[model samples]
Target: MAKMVTKSILMPAALAAALDAEARDKKISLSELARAALSDRINLAAIESRLIARLDAQDEAMAKIIALVSSLEAVDEPEGGVTQ
Candidate 1:
């Protein structure tokens, strides 16, 4: 047997009606529809977090590259391209 858990949620009347209609179309209970919606939200959050982390890493790498280029530019070059 499966266990059941109860939760309370508040939503705007229009949104609630939409959810009910969608649930009816899917032939699923309102509870199931709500659970699926919540699960989808959790999945989206996880993906967004990963994307943010990757962007941050890329930004850090770019900053390091810029610093290296600046340091090379600051070096003094001999009058001649090659110093014998």
Candidate 2:
């Protein structure tokens, strides 16, 4: 198990009230609710980062393919509009 330390955070009064209401409705302690929410947000951010990286890689690959095809077409065309 990891060592646990308690930390305090400040939020807007309205947001705090909402969090309290949600915790009460869910029948969980405020700490538990906050911890779960924080964990979920962190996980979601990691997933989003991985997705962005993959999309960037795919974009680079598509650009390369497009450039290669364009070069090939240029090479295949003759100056006199004649077919080989």
Candidate 3:
């Protein structure tokens, strides 16, 4: 049975005296330290959007292993005794 809402935010007297000295060093209550700093900035923006989609899938798997090592260095052999 908990539901009590009230609104009015205009901080800036030095950020409301640094959110009232961080709600008196965590004893909480400046509205639960502004709802735990807005729920830790919405859980750090959902963990930085899942670490930027796993760093864009490891940069598309290193661009397909640098196009298979530039197509095996443009193959070109067989000049004397070996071409198998």
- In terms of TM-score, the best-performing candidate is 2
- Per-residue accuracy of model 1 over 1-84 as CA lDDT, tens digit each: 111111112123434565666678789998887688687832434444554565456667867998999777666555565456
Q: What lDDT does each candidate get?
A: 0.57, 0.59, 0.53
Better of 2 and 3 by lDDT: 2
lDDT of 2 by residue, 1-84 (tens): 111111112123434565676678779988887687787732434444554565456667867999999989888889776585
The window of 10 residues in a row where model 2 has the poorest summed lDDT is 1-10
Q: Report the lDDT tens digits of candidate 3 across residue range 13-32.
A: 43455557657866777887
Best by lDDT: 2
Candidate 1: deviation at residue 61, Å?
0.0
In model 1, pairs of residues that clash are none
TM-score of each: 0.43, 0.47, 0.28
Residue pairs with backbone overlap in model 2: none
Pick by TM-score: 1 or 3, better one: 1
The clash number for model 1 is 0
